[model samples]
Target: MTRSWIGRRAVVAATFLLALSPLAPAAAAPPVVEAAGAALRPAGAEVVAVTKVAERLTDLSVRSPALGGRVVKVRLLTPDGWNPADRRQHWPSFWLLAGCCGDYTAWSGTDIAKIESLRKVLVVMPEAGWNGWYSNWWNHGAGGDPAWETFHTVELRRLLEKDWGASSNRVVAGLSMGGQGALLYAARHPGMFRAAAAYSASAHPLLNTESINRIMGFFGGQGGDPRRVWGDPVAQRNIWAAHDPYYLAHHLKSLPLYLSSGDGTAGPFDQPDALEADFNRQNKALAAALTQAGAKRLTTNFYGPGTHAWPYWQRELHSSLPILLTALNVRP
Candidate 1:
């Protein structure tokens, strides 16, 4: 009986030892973690997770130091034969930024993922925050945290180029607030984009008081302090001008540009009672500024009877693709 008890104890001990053996098969890492660690992280950022949402759509949750160590989502509409694990492959990138209240998924929420003309390029749609304005928040002159500009242009750009298959050749397009971002990024960083397009953009917000008030209203959205973004417009006039695309027109003269907008009237895509959009005059002013600044490769579609809506922006996207793709040296 004692020997029987000893044998039972020995059996249990052997089973426990076998379970701890180094030769035992280890548990596999989560697919998301494996994918996140597949590539080298950018200097101040790391991809925390990756989700394959669909056939060609991937959502990367990145932890950004520029954004105060916040984790944000960035959607990738990958091209055919593109592989994140393969470092040798690089495709031209199309940055489709979202508007003030929208997230990174805004463009994919449209039919852009199905557009065949965009199949050959890597479409990077990053979260610019709700009312992020695509600018580093002034934060009362402290100048840190929630730095959208550095997050996008520096950390995210480097990550995509190093890990994901994004080439140096790039084009940018957006609507509304994002349209402003598209233009600002191109102008602020010379040679960053091959071409730029904006639809129904608040192009010249510094043109007058009405425009200034309108944007200040946007700045005050979602319980945010208007002063946190760029400070008092009166006090921070230089900062405001620095971010205004109209004021930066001279910097954009060399790149291919596509500017299109509606007169804010009811058009084919709008209801009969659609109110006029206030951005028409802004677009017109920006177009003139670009031309006057010696922009030779500019295209303006200011289609007369439209409104600032998705239908018009979608159409404008299709219309501008030829120029965008041409600038990227990709066939439409």
Candidate 2:
């Protein structure tokens, strides 16, 4: 009996050891990390209730078989009668602009979708990778730098137009840094977009190095030189001037332009109060420069008791929605 007990104990010990062994691969995890305070997030802006036209209208990322290394994540909003197979008449589309540190979800996550439902247009939110600046990079020689212009104008646009059936004529707009990108891109490629808007844009990057440094730090990495992306303000004067939307004042006259900035004094990025004052002054200077440069097709607004926040952006969109819709000839 004692010998039997010993054998049974040995067997139990061996089983325990095997259980502790690290032979198995780890379990797979869900793709997205649920952010803190996300549980209480409310449904975004309101739209007319319609059957969900597409499968799982949520955050999705796709690698381009066409564009090679380009990986794009989109928060897509398909309208009531969307058909991927049918190449029917295209519907008007608005590309949702993402702020610095934002992905494609900014529009759908906020009250943007609710507001968008009021308009009869498709809204596409593309993940313009964190700090991509919407400009293709120079030093990224690996899978290669992001071909943002081509991706937006050619690759993704083609896929969206073919599969989703959005209109060929489009409008683009965004908040803060995205605002800067939208305006700059529209100015550079006048024929690509019909109307554009920027809310609290870091527009006057030419006048100050501090804002440029922030942008450079976001995209080029800490201590990385800015010249590779934007070039030196002094040495590469022409390149810098070309990027400044205000400097490209003649281009602004042709495209529908809307610009807005709150007094930065009460914003999140502001510090020590005095610094916010300086930023507000700089943005004001940019607006003044635009006005002086004979910008005709332009509408500028400076809101009171406001700061650079999603709430302010949401409100601004409400005001701009009618104007943009009218400009695009979409009925209210």
CA lDDT scores, all candidates in order: 0.76, 0.57
Q: After TM-score superposition, what is the CA distance of residue 58 in candidate 2 from its true location, in Å?
A: 4.9
- lDDT (tens digit, per residue) of candidate 1 on 141-191: 264447888788888989999999998899999988888999988887777
Worst 10 residues of 1 by lDDT: 21-30
- Name the lDDT of candidate 1: 0.76
Q: After superposition, how far is residue 200 of candidate 2 from its true place, in Å?
A: 0.9
Best by TM-score: 1
Task: Give the TM-score (vs. native) of candidate 2.
Answer: 0.73
- Model 2 lDDT tens row, 1-332: 12211222112222222212110101112112112122221112121222343442544355543334555676667655655568875778877688766667676656655554534677777766666666544333334545454455555666667666677768888876677778776766656678888876767655554444434444444334444554454554555566665566556666677777776555543322322233355557766766777766777777644555666677777667765666667775
**Inter-residue clash pairs, candidate 1:** none
Query: Which ten contiguous residues of candidate 2 have the minimum total lDDT?
Result: 21-30
